[model samples]
Target: MQLISTLATIGFVLPLFLALVGVLLARRDYGVAAAWGGGVMMALLVALAIRGVLRGDPDLPHFPSGHVTLAVAFYGGLLAIYLRGGLNRDRTAVPVILATLAAIALLEGVSRILLTEHTWVDVLGGFAVGSLGLLATGCPWAVRRIRAGSRLWLAATLAVATPIAFMTVGWLDGLIRHWVTL
Candidate 1:
């Protein structure tokens, strides 16, 4: 449970995989890609800020689970892009894929509790934060405009997210150490 939860923690897996799929199957429009990544970024930063301020348990902040937030916001945004990109044919796999992501998010949340990394409140907070982030980045709005230099936005996101990913490897013990820590 710990291992799976760790692997699912917003590292570079889901977004990268979805990006590649978008490039291969869809038009690889920068709007969709940028929005998806932007949503994840926004959610993560916001969640971290909340955790810092609220202070969860004695270790790291515990109001929200960043892993669960990432799973929902990032994976949920991917579903939005996948559907909005207009893959009308062969719709059979959509539900299956969507269900799989939902299951992953749910299990990740549960695993966090089982592993004592978070509580029910943390998981619920994660869901809320993730949803807000997804909504903020225009996920369900279907922004497909292919403006110039949109690809640069994705590269920029990667540049920003990479360093943060390192932080998730092992959070600071007994110290509120997020970039947004108050």
Candidate 2:
């Protein structure tokens, strides 16, 4: 369990750190890449949920957990973007930003531990997922799509996809829970 927990933490946090670097190094494209990656991951999770529902064997009961991941990724990415956009105006800005994000991360970690809904690894795994998101969408192809199409397309995709993402999270969570009890 300790090994799993430690690995989970590394897996979860490493990606975010990498993504942060990418975002900071003028690889703004990585930010979009991360967002789309999250969307895709959520979509896959949702698909699993639908399958479980049709089979009448909802497994996990951890949809909110999925949302928690999404929230972290979404908000973290947003903060990264804001910082990149020159919001770090004062010298204290960077520290303030880091502190706030750290607090959120700590809260998330502690909350999961207390709730017992997830192990440390599971919570940290969210961080890993978010990090991969940063790398996955940073490819040149993705940049082209974002450039060729209007922001409207991206926005529309998000609007339609968000609910699907949430549903998928819920459904898979149920399935996982059901399976574990068996």
- The candidate that wins on TM-score is 1
In candidate 2, which residue ranges exceed 4 Å CA deviation? 1-64, 87-89, 136-182
What is candidate 1's lDDT per residue for 67-114, written digit by digit as tens?
788878876765665555445467897798689768878888999999
Write candidate 2's Cα lDDT for 74-153 as tens digits: 44544444443443236686677667755565566566667676666555655555554434434344443232222333
Considering every candidate listed, which one attains the maximal lDDT? 1
For candidate 1, the 10 contiguous residues with the lowest summed lDDT are 173-182
TM agreement with the true structure for every prediction: 0.68, 0.42
Candidates' lDDT values, in order? Answer: 0.67, 0.45
Candidate 1 TM-score over all chains jointly? 0.68
